[model samples]
Target: MSVEPKMPKCWRKESKPHKFCPGCGHGLALKALGMAIDELGIQDKVVFGCDIGCSLLAWDFFDVDIVQTHHGRTTPVITGLKRANPDLIGIAYMGDGGGYAIGSQHLVNAATRNEKITAILVNNTNYGMTGGQMAPTTLPNQKTETSPYGRSIEETGYPTQGPEMVAAIARDEAYAARGTVANMRQLKGFFKKALQNQIDGNGFSFVEVLSTCPTNWRTDAKGTWKYLEEEMTKFFKVGEFKTPAAKGEQS
Candidate 1:
């Protein structure tokens, strides 16, 4: 195995506040994460590394320790955190662009090496914090600031299927799943499996969450729900891609 970096101490202060917009999916994702850690009683053991975009807004969401990394670079930080502290539950929370585009190389390598970490990849479709830009996970022909005329197939192609991509490379012992926060009950189950993957000592668990970006999409909150439910779910199916049992071991 390759050498890993050391985990640092938790460094969140009470005065710091989360910067996410109201009704943003990132805030819900963070809430799920916090609930999972709290239920498992591992708040102190979680080391959060949030990448750029709305994900960075989660910097102060949790009461545990936290760290910020450059755009699309949370994978390396999480990798280092796991290697440094085997006991720590290292999580890399990042936006679609940060994960599938700028940080893809790191993501693939991390999965290949079976790095012991959990990555919560938020695919809000459009780039929210970056003025509604098109990301690698942007759906086919999705309109954005740069693609007012719609994304060109010859240039942009289709959005990357992240869970499928990781599952293709993951070892049998690893876990990969897709989930959505459109509803509360489903969200709880998804978050449970995500955190369980970490507790199981399984390597390289991934949860690709199909999220909403109402502000960027220039849609009302109700419209965001409709898109997430009617359209985005069609393109990005949500479910578990890998599991401990399928990995040739008891789950």
Candidate 2:
């Protein structure tokens, strides 16, 4: 007898055939998020907040309550909502541009404040939604719509390591980790741990998902996976930056 695959109840079955581009990593990230919610049995308590950009398309992907915020405002909105309702699990989903460039300050403030929230920062290097512009996390020499001749390190500077930055300001109760969609199991584990941190009332939890934008990156499916594993992984190393377990307590 063959066993059927289990689907996450948190996902809206009607929302099948998501709008994400072919080989896009957004779907993987969403799947991981949904799985985490189901595993933690917090499907009813998750209040997802998605920022403008490609990430905003996830507004209706889940069966749980969701709010779509303007560009660079996802973090603050989720933070406020979580503060108002302490029993809810607030989640902020954002793209590289929304999380690292326009909303960089908000993200830093939220992490430093140790707000009871879980942030999923999807870093695909360039801005995937708006014609492949150079994002704050865009790698040096990477060619984008804005950086036609390849990004200049001296002029554009280096990519921002979001997880490391958040970890630097996070307290012992907080959690920070970096995982890539290239490693599906590890990525889901990171998502689950991040959600658990918030559910445990341990303060803030930040997870950076190194994803891919095949359409914008001008690559096919295989190339996308190769790029994520070879190029992107070199700059944004994956691993947990901080965990509650490090403080002699279970995470």
Candidate 3:
């Protein structure tokens, strides 16, 4: 007899053998999120919204209701849902391009307003769905279809520090963290906390996950792990940047 792989109860079994490319990190990120939802027992109250990039592939990844939005619009859509029905646990999922580039304004405004929603952004460094174009989070020396000669820092500037930005702008009750797919347990912990923050009626919550895209990266298994565990961590610095203060403590 063969032992079956354990999956999150909120995950759709029919969607098993997901559509993400081999070695893609979105699956791992989503798995962690699914586990968080299962542990929190808020599957019914969760309203998931995914952006138009590779993140859109997760439209049916979960058994919960999901809204697929245009590129960079997931944040506003989720914000609207949460505002209309404060009981809903709104989660906006998107890629770096969607969150940092096209959707950056929505992200910034939401953080400034301290919207009661959780935003999960997967930073793979490139526009994976759009033929590996250089994105806002692409490293300085990284090369992509649009940056074939390697990204120039002088022209492009550094990668977007997403968690840092969110933590700096969001109110004291907000939560911000940077997690990686290499560490599933830690990533899931961050996801759970972010969701719990929303459940507690806290302000905006954001988690940026460093993920892998071997197909767009043109890397083998060894290279993929090297980039994800070693290279990416150097710049991303996975950790919680900010969290809600204790009950009676100063923020």
Candidate 4:
């Protein structure tokens, strides 16, 4: 009789448990990314670059070659990686605050350069690892340490649409999209496409995944998922912004 092969683990089991709050969204996002790579059969060629903020969790979670970049600098690191070795799949994973606020310049520059890589921005709305401070993506009237009374647009301005905002800088409008992970199905699709962008050698593919920071959002997993579903998607619409064909591929 033939025996069945061993099934691969979820990659979450590889985490060191070094740091990260209870039920942190970073863990789940990293797991989803790994599963996506696995599904696409490209884990061997993926180079994961993680930004500061909570995104650093991905550094320890994946078996791929990892790079720890400066706060908001993961973009350039991944860009350079892809440029130098176009055969490798480069991914820059950054949180909302790190990618949109502090690393905003790098984010735009990468798109402007039209570097072939996958940039995944995880928007949890608040600064999760940093004492629950108000972030650039915080919704209207959202309360946080920095915006105790709620985020004031007149004073602080509104949040940035990282994916849509950067699409203009992109070379084409085929693989860029603003999506979320409230549902497993959507999350799977987002990650799968992100990997495909790299494999296809698309100039740039940006996916802003709206995640839940249970600790910073001040809600448990259930409540956080609800908030991500009902409240978060309202601000960041989900859909593709760019999808142009790569050098030698069909749409």
Clash count list over all predictions: 3, 0, 0, 9
**Residue lDDT tens for model 1, 117-197:** 988899988788879998887777778998998888788888889999899998876778888877645665666676777
Pick the lDDT winner: 3
Per-residue lDDT of candidate 4, residues 1-251 (tens digit)? 97643323435344555366786666566666767888888878888899998888667666678898989999998888788888999999999988888998888887887778888888888888788898989988889999999999899888778877776777763367776665556676777886787687656777888887777778977887788889887788888776676566775
The C-alpha stretches of model 2 lying farther than 4 A from their native spots are 1-6, 246-251
- Residue 181 lDDT, candidate 2, scale 0-100: 87
Comparison by lDDT, 3 against 4, better one: 3
User: Which pairs of residues collide in model 3?
Assistant: none
**Which ranges in model 1 have alpha carbons more than 4 Å from their true place?**
1-18, 246-251
* lDDT tens readout by residue for model 3, 206-239: 9999999999999999999999898888789999
List the candidates ranked by TM-score, beginning with the highest: 3, 2, 1, 4
lDDT for model 1 comes to: 0.80
Q: What are the per-model C-alpha RMSD values against the true structure?
A: 7.7, 2.3, 0.8, 3.9
Q: After superposition, how far is residue 199 of candidate 3 from its true place, in Å?
A: 0.3
TM-scores for all predictions: 0.89, 0.95, 0.98, 0.89
